[model samples]
Target: MSSTPDDSTAVIRKTALNAVHRKLGAKMVDFNGWDMPVEYPAGLIAEHLAVRSGVGIFDVSHMGDIRVSGRQALPAVQHITMNDASKLQLGQCQYSAMLYPQGTFVDDVIVHRFGENDFFFVINAGTREKDIAWVRENTRSFDCKVEHLSDDFTQIAIQGPRGVDVLQKLTDADLSKVKFYWFTRGTVCGLQDILIARTGYTAEDGFEIYVPTDTATSERVWNEVLAAGKEFGVLPCGLGARNTLRLEGKLALYGHEISDSITVWEAGLDRWLKMDKAEFIGRRSLERQQTDGVTRTLVGLEMIERGIGRDGYKVLDENGKQIGQVTSGSYAPFLKKNIDLAYVPLSHAKVDAVVGVEIRGNAVKAKVVPTPFYKRPKRS
Candidate 1:
């Protein structure tokens, strides 16, 4: 970690959209090394409900953006990732995990295929610098170039039912054709030649726009997005609402749900791992774990009793035996109940299985439930 100039207190970096967030009266907090907005006057619960019902915008500029461009782009990425990059066509994006040589997770990343020789990766904020360093070390053998572009670009996610509607008003691109996990170069808010990806943390219709760092352009795009989204009920959301929204969607958090000590198979992400694609870091260990059967698994839990199960809370059996621990939890505004994701033995992860969470030294009843506590209605 880098030290601050004062050396007495921690210094948090502010984003290009920090002014906008503060102007909206957002509750700011130290997230990792960044000063981020956690919530707004609308509150976490209200913002969660609004996204489930309407639309919202989030400043995710803190997330790291890296560009990998060279003749060996595909093979270079495939060598480091667990997913098969050969099948990825231009404009397609795939979620993947980077593993150590031993197969333990380093970080889960999203790769966007811009062209045959160019690609983009969006990595977790907490692991930004570490992830870049890992990529550079691993790609040393491959004939590829990886550049950390986090400082050059900023990201904004417009999520929910009306995301496209508001984006279309600002951009000339035909958004309907940009399917899920795909991207295109287009003009947004009069900024020509920018990349837009149809992706988001919230499990809803949305788009994540990458804006280059330029004072005039960033300011104009940020303000125009909010202005155009007025009729769509677009709310400027913070990390608090962002967390709740992702929790309801069952999206994995890097440090919480997954970390350098865990493997993807144990995290319920085997479907995203492509073992048949030759080989990748940690393949042998993960393959061994798969054959031996994983001991612990990540699953969703619903509180059958009162109290919200928070991170670090222990899960116990009916007989008061410690079974597992909650990784992330909250009072889901859409479900109107407490929901959480926990790591427990596979034997106790069945749906409807009884469990108890230790909250404030008291045992609260809970039950194993299907993940993705809420899903948006499919548009016809």
Candidate 2:
């Protein structure tokens, strides 16, 4: 459970599992007006390492879930997003982004297709309201219904190599048969109406389970998963570990890696943008940028100096001239080194290109390396 206040004076909203988080002695912090746990008693490093070597669970209930349905759902999704939603088969999910008319991101989202006319979108928590409003405003031209389901569901992420082993004990679904990016509706921990998806933010084989917001069901599932995972050295992780895990995998964060000012081309996500498909929002601008070429591109950086590169840190050329800025940075627990993602001029994005990162008012040498500092081995 969570220890945050619930009175009118409180500014943050607590998740249904807030009390359970508090009971587990989690160190809670204000994450964009949500009282979320940053770490547990074992600390961030321990939690992070657990996910890399074994299994760990995360409370990601703050994520937004939006439903788009009706006869024109496919068309509505296709018009607003850059990806081709028509290609998605039932129970399939595609990683896509919504862009503004200026070719910059509105948000990066995961599009999950439930059926021919039903689609579920998982969006960033901080931008939930704005994304919902954007969807509603632009989707009015289509014959679809957009519903915000963020408040009606809770999400838990079970990650790492042993993720399947632990979760298989609780869910009746055939864990081994769920392919990556696919989802199935099944009973979890004897509870009905749960959606289990073979998807995760961490660079590992995992599952993200979505359950109803009913307090009793939420508590039961959370506790039962913990009990089932105890033998696998499963630890309850927090946002801090989640950040490190995702950073090692070079995953994009909303406000940091990709934001309102960052275009999809600059963010190194052009493959997901289907230019051949019918026109969508930002299509013209993105097409122009593609033809002209983007000035700056996102790249991965490895620190050569002792200091750690952090967000907003200036990326400078060899002569100390500002070239770009770091978006996401951290000391990756799995890699055992300081790594970061930054946007630099196209000239400096080559592999092994040396750049300087401003850390604590001093210039620290860093090398532009290949992205996804870490990648999981293929399962045999």
Off by over 4 Å in 2: 1-10
lDDT (10s digit) by residue, model 1, range 103-128:
77888899998889787899988888
- Top candidate (TM-score): 2
Per-residue lDDT of 1-380 in model 2, one digit per residue for the tens? Answer: 23222222246778888888999999999997888999999999999999999999999998888999999999999999999999999999999999999889999999999999899999988888889999999999999999988887779999999999999998889978889999998889887868999999998889999987777778888899899999999999999999999999988999998998999989989888899999899999998898999999999999998989999999999999999999999899889999999999989999999999999878899999997999998876
Q: Which regions of candidate 1 deviate over 4 angstroms? A: 1-10
- How displaced is residue 105 in candidate 1, in Å? 1.4
For residue 145, model 2's alpha carbon misses the true position, in angstroms, by 0.8
State the TM-score for model 2: 0.97
